[model samples]
Target: MKKVLMAIVVISILITAPLIYNRAKIEWNNDTYEMIVPYEEIRELAIRGLDTDTIVKTLYDNGVRGISFEPTGIQDLVKQGLVMTLTKSDLFSMLQKEDENTRESILYSRENGLYVLLRNDLDDRWENAIVKSFGDRIDKVTDLPIFKGESIYFIKGISKEELTRGMGAVANPILTRPIGFDENLMTEFASYGFEPVFRIGNNINENNEYVLDQMKQLQDKLGGHKIIFTGNTMLGVAPHKDLKTEDAEQYALRLVNEGFVLMPIEFTKQDGLNIYAKQFNNKIVRLHSLDFFDGRGGYTDRATRAVKERNIRGLYVHVADIKKLEEETITAEQSFEVATQELEAITSQMADKHQPGIAQSYDLLQASKWMTIAGLVGVAAFIGLAALMVSEKIALLTFAGMLLVAAGYIVTGATMFLQAASLVVSIVAATWAAISGEYINSKKDMVFKFLKGAFLALIGVWFVMSLLYGNQFLVKIEEFRGVKLLFILPIVLTFLHVIRDHVKDLAMTVVRNYYLVIVAVIAAGLMILVVRSGNDAGEMVSGTELVLRQKLEDFLFVRPRTKEFLIGYPLLVLGMYIIYQGKGWEQRIGKYLLAGGAIGFLSTVNTFTHLHIPIYLSLLRTVYGFVFGALLGLVLIFLYRLAKKYWPMIQERL
Candidate 1:
């Protein structure tokens, strides 16, 4: 019983192995910094093609995650969910509430999964009042210190776009906030998994004994919490020269060495070595594009060359930018909502456009490589197996067909037509030889076998005709080079089986008259080529961008109909039809003929992109092809009926 149970468990493990193997997960390592980029915000930047590096910095400063927003409250009248907004009335009410309820509100705010911002610069006496609102539940704020404001002054009467423009301004209210370090906030932050951030003036001495004293005290209490240095370092200058800069870097380096993270909050682009990389040599990881958050275009500083060369992490945007959007007299919640929606739309669009196609292209290339190797092995095995299973004549033919297919594939990078033609030829030959060998031994049902052969012969003749004509047309088109061996050849063999049968039985009367047919087609093709050449006499010119001139140059000198098309046409049509067509395959056969004729006509018509064709001439060319195809179809029908009428009498003598 124990053995049985162990066996079942092993079987289950085997079944589930593939699912585990293929699961997608985020890859992280010490060498490769894994910054969790908020994808949605990044896309807005991409659409505008703005600076990417600044976008990343803004996101990190704001503590923004790529998560969707949850509704904050229900609208009273409309009964719809509303996002949290900043308003004087709400701030006043929340502040006026007892400390218990205020704390309760803050905890509840987080409980509902929405970010809670403590209204700012209210007096310390009011802090007790705010604390009374929550009672003992102050510890319930999970995942961070309560974001506080030193001075809670609202910008008066400004359009949201104008405020967005002011995000980079020195006069921005966000810049003037007083610095305060709270030990209580730090304790509470550790309990709730939030790192306490202190805002200090950019000019604060890095080596200041007071700041070091405060950091050591906090480190001792919290066991190691990051101190966020918030200030703008002057652009295009050495941060080391500034006393405050040296202190900030020293503090960050010491903390980082001692298992603490130092995050500097800078409003502008300046060198601070928060994140260092070989690609971005000597530059600090800080927000850039301090110009403005126009909402239309985001600020990004990612290198374009970098994007092309390496995998990108993601993008970020400032939460203040989202909030500033609401200062347009609209609620802050509504502003965040709009920004969130915009972010989602942009990210979705970018992912849809780029990911799917790139993935498919990659997968196809991989499959092609594996499939080619597997096919070669399969061919070799089949040849060996056939030599043992069949007569030398049939096995040799099969082997020859396989070799041709392999050669074609090697030369052209594809063997679809060659492989298909080989298969058809092998099957038809094997069947014919087996039946003929049986009849010669037994002398039974020879007439029936002969009839089948005659049918096959007819099929082969049709296949040959189509292959030749199609190749003639295909070779004329510049794009049809490698396509012939892989596609056109096999297609011809598919239809040639009927002719093969006729040849096997010696019932083909068409071969006796094949010379006459070939001569007639050659004559017609020559006349058409001459007429096409004559039409281009004056239109063709050297150094011209005209389509006719370019085509004439090609047709006259390089890859002319006489050399390539004439030889390729017969093989192409015959091979293509034999492979692609089925019994009662008139429609399939017709399509092949039509495609060839269409190419022939289209080749002569000028298709220069820069050179515009006159509307009248274009219309004339369209009508000319239509009339030509119709006439040609009619003439072929007449020839087929003529052949059918005399085929029986001529076959009797043969």
Candidate 2:
């Protein structure tokens, strides 16, 4: 009775301590930095070969957060000094109203000190039209295409197709506004050697289905470098009360699922923008426009305010009228200072907002095919070792083996890759140490007993570290409350074996009465309810990410991490008969596996209690593990009885 009580007390401590330690050790992180600036601003600074800090500081100071003007032939114009004229539609309208020809328009632009950049959706006959109307030479924009002639210089971003063949293009891909054909036109353009830097999908329709479909198709074809934007997606009025954040979040998740990797700024006043910033900070580049040389300085202040308020990661600036911007007294130096100061402020705030939450642990098994196999094999070896009685010397060797393997994994930098293997090692060592410590206690050898208990305690520490932080020594806070039956089952079973002699009669009486089977089944049902309650809950391997684990269960007719249900519980029942029914290896092995049912019961219910896993799914998984495992256990028990009866005939034949 004393031994049984001691075993229970020690097991109780062993099970809860690691979980508490792991929970206490978790760390959570929520810090991100993102922004944009103009192409010319980034280029001019880079070309000047300024110090990197100076460049970053200058860009940030100037409010250059997100879209840096992509370096291309535009720098050549920047060298001649940039002056903006009317937009394409406005320019064409003015030409029609004034009856001015292309040459006269170019000449008028030059007189205003503007560099005329032609926006050509202009038909292929533009050269002939210009020649007929203005009697001027029209140049073909080719690879190595240069225009020194004071006429209208065409300024579309040169594609990679042009650059690879000794031609110069803008560093960015051109914006392709597909006509009525939509993304199909984009496909047509890509096939014909047009590479868009980013795609803009017009999503202002009654339902955004067409826009969403086009974006998905474009992302699939265009690849990673090209980002697709949902231009005015849900373009209704903002202050955000009208715009649902949930709707925007769904749209964002859908875009990511479909592989659109970046986002541009839309309506900023909406809290939905913050949702986007939180959800897609790394995946999407959300921009706040500073509008550096625009006529209104009012836009600049609002842009800064939005950056601070919404945690918007990047800033963009597009200046059309340099002359109009001068009236606001916004100098290049002043803008640079403002951007740098704002960026510095954002950085400072990011540092403060950081809290020591749960440390993150990545799944080591999910990374590679080879590592996956290694983990599964490790589990097999661990179960094999844990199923038998071994000497104290063998237990010490097991302890040393875990240390050696962990050391090897660390040196090879494969700790994360061998996470499951490391976990098995730690568990086996801890289990053996615990059982050995109890043996020493029975002998009343105080000094040796203390030493064994100390070793067990040390192994317990290693178990927590290996299971919680993993190989990378990082703890993801979400793991704090997660249950790991991997450690709990084996070690608890080991201690149960140490108490078997003391609890034998009581165990056999229950088994002989046929009550153990009933208890195991009832326990399975009750555990399902405990799984619904947070504090008392166990665990199950739930969630969609456990892809391979689920696959193995489907293929093998046994669930992964469910050995306790199928193997452990049935062995417990079988062992009860074997202990008194037979002698030799069968009896001894039965003694070793007698705790399987108890361990199995734990395996079923706890598998569902994984912190983030849904309760309904967890219940279904637990029930399946229990029923299947119980059925298999019955088969093994029947087989063992048959083998025992046939042993005399088999011996005579041999």
How close is every model to the real structure, measured as TM-score?
0.25, 0.29
Candidate 1's residue-wise lDDT over 101-123, tens digit each? 56555435432111223334434
Where model 2 places Cα greater than 4 Å from the true spot, the runs are: 1-565, 579-588, 595-602, 609-613
Predictions in order: lDDT = 0.32, 0.41
Tens digits of per-residue lDDT, candidate 2, 1-654, equal 224423532453444444334433331121233344444454444444435456654544433333321211223332444322233444445445444556354434332111234344433332233223222222332211133332453333333344444655433222221212233334543453333334344322332244345445555675323342433433222334654445556766666566444545534333344454334433343445655445455453344334322333344444322332345455544545554665554444333333111111222211233332333333333333443355545544654455465456556754343454434544454454434423221223523532443344333333333243321222111232423544354536664664567576455653444666766874674465335434223455466635665465445433434455555445554554455455665565545554443454344333432322222334455556545655676688689878868989999999
Q: Distance from true position, residue 116, model 2, in Å?
A: 11
Alpha-carbon lDDT of model 1: 0.32
Q: Among all windows of ten consecutive residues in candidate 1, which has the lowest summed lDDT?
A: 356-365
Error of 2 at 252 (Å): 11
